[model samples]
Target: MSHTLLNESNADQYRTRVTLLGTAGGPPWWDGSDRTGISTVISVNDDHYIVDLGEGWGPQFRKSNLGPVGFQKGLDNVRAVFVTHHHSDHIVDLPNLLLLAWHNGSDGLKSPIQIYGPGNRGELPPIFAPENREQLPEVFNPDSPTPGLTESAAKLMEAYALDINDRMRDNAKQDLRDVFEFHDIELPGTTGDRPNEDPTPEMEPFEVYRDENVRVTAILVDHRPIFPAFAFRFETADGSVVVSGDTGVCENIVKISADADMLLHECIDMDWVDTLMGPNSPKPDANLMQHMLAAHTSIEQVGPQAQAARVKSLVLTHLVPGNTPAEKWQQAAAGYDGDFYVGEDLMQFGIGAPRG
Candidate 1:
C-alpha cells in the first residue's frame, strides 16, 4: 500500500485529529470495553505523533484507523513518541512499538522514532528500614537511583539485542540504530542545580519537539515523589490540544491548556476505587488510598480544572475504574458546562471543530 507523506505543500488538506487509542488507566484487560491503556495519537495531517505508548498500544494503534495505510503499515507511519512518565501501564509496549515499526517497511520511515521524556530522579527514598523487614531488597535502598526514560530505553534495547541481531542478520539493510532515538528532557540550570530543575520559582512549559506540522511543549506537573511527570501541549495552525499525562489536580496542566481547543485529562472515580479495596481485600490500606488521591485526579476535580484552564472542550480519559458506565462519569462535569466527552477507545475528535 502506498503511504501519503505529510509535507508543507499538502498540509492544508488535513486538519489536526486526536484519537483516543487506549483509554484504560491501570493495565491492559478486557472488562466489557476494549480499553487497553493510556495512549493518544495526535495527528497533524499525515504526521502522526503518539503520546504515552501504554500497554497494548501497539495493537490499539493498528486498529485506530488514523492513516490511509492499514494494519502494520499504520504503525510505520508513526513520526515520534512522547512518554509522560515511566509508569509500567503507560510504557509497557515500548519495545513492541519500536520493533514493529522497524520491521515493517513504510515510506518516509528513515528518521529514528524520537522518544522524549523526563530524566531520572536522583535517588529513591527508603521504602522500608533494614531492621523492619525479613529480607531487605535493593529496590528499597535510598541511594539507588530510578532510571530515566532514556536510560530505560537503552536497557530495553539491550535486553532485545538478540532478537534485533537476528533480524538484522536476516536483512543487512535493517539497522536497529536507524529505527530509534531517545531524548531526556531537562530544565535549564546553573552550576549547582539539578539538570531537570526549573530555573525559576514558577514552573513553566518548555518546547520539547517541533516539526512541519506541530510544535510540542511540556510542563512539569505534581505527580510528586514520582518527581517529574509532564503534561503536554500540541499546537498546530488548525488548533491546540493538551494531554494531561496521568496527573493530579495540576496547575501546570491548567496553565499549558489555557484556551486550548481541547483538553484530554485523566479522571479517576475514587469512590469506585475504594469499594474495590474494601476491608476484606488484599489491597494495601490507607497508604494506597493516600497515594491514589495524591497521584490521580478525581472526577469531581476534572471539571474545575477544565474550567480554570478555559479549554474549549474537556475529554476525560485514562478512566481509573475502566469498567464504569459512561453515565457514572457524567456528574464529573456538573458545573462549568463546556463540551464534555466520556473518552472511549478509538474515539476520534477533530481539533478546532465544534463538539459533536
Candidate 2:
C-alpha cells in the first residue's frame, strides 16, 4: 500500500497530527544511518505535546517548526511532555529540553509546562544472565540509585548549578522550576505492586492527565526489567493517537491502543539480533539474545500486536539497529491490514478528517 506523506503545507487538513522529531532507537550510533534518537510530537492545532526526549530532539524539534519562530520564540506553544520510560535512548536528552527552554522561549508560557514520567522502580533490576552474575557491577548513586522523574530533574539542575546560577544572576533568567513542573506518574492502586517480578500486570489503562485539547491515558507495557514502562494514548477532538514506547508483545499495549486512529510502535529486526548474538557467531551468548528479544518487539511480532489493537494506522518508529533497510522493516505489516508506514525523522501524519 502507498503511504501518503504529510507536511506543514497540508497540516491544516487535520486538527490533530503527529510529527516524528527523530526515529532512531538505542544509544549506539548506527553505521551508515543518519537517523537521530526516538522522539515524537502530537500537535493539536498550534499547541503541541512532546513524547520522549531522545538525543538530538532539540534540534529536530526546532527544525520541525512545531512552535513559533524568531529569537526566544520557540517552545512557546508546548503544552506538555510525556516520557514513556527512563530508558537512556528514550530520555537521554531530557536535560536539553529542561536547560535550554529558557533560551527557546519558555518564559512566555501561559502556564508551567507539565512533564510526566514513570516514578522510581523502588529497586534495581536483577542481573540478566546467571553466568555473568559471578562478578556484580557496582551500582552508581547508591543512595538514590532509582531516582524518579522529580529527583532526576532536581539533580540535573543541581549538576548544572554553576551555569544556572550565572544565567539567573547575570542574564536575569528565571528559575527553571518556575518554567516547568515535574510529575511522577503514579500507578493505580495495587497495579504495579510487583514491579521486578512482574513488571507489566494485566490492567486497564488509567487516566494520567486531561486538558482542553487532549485526555491522556497510560498502561504498563512489558519492556522487561524496566518497571513502569508505559504505552500512552492521547485522545483529542480530532482523533486518538497511541505511542507504544518500547516493548515486546504485551497485551497491555493492545489494551491501551484499542480503536485508536494511529499507533506509532517500535520494531526490531530479529535477523540483526541473531546475526550479532545467535549461535555460530564468533562468541555466541544465548542468554544475551534471549534478553534482547525479551525487551524489544521483533518486526514479525509488532504487526500482530497492531492488528490486535485494531488501530486505523500503524507507523513504525524507534527502529532497532537504526541502519536496517526499509524493506526489512516492512515485514511489520504482515498481519496488519490497516495502513502501515515506516516512520522517518521529521515526518508528520494528519489524523482523522479535515475541519469543515
Report the CA-based lDDT of candidate 2 relative to the real structure.
0.89
On the 0 to 100 scale, the lDDT of residue 127 in model 2 is 73
What does candidate 2 score on TM?
0.96
User: Which candidate number would show the highest TM-score if scored against the true structure?
Assistant: 2
Stretches off by above 4 angstroms in model 1 are 1-14, 28-30, 68-71, 125-137, 140-144, 190-201, 277-284, 353-356
Model 1 scores a TM of 0.85
Candidate lDDT (C-alpha), each: 0.75, 0.89
lDDT of 1: 0.75
- Which candidate tops lDDT? 2
Regions of model 2 farther than 4 Å from truth: 1-4
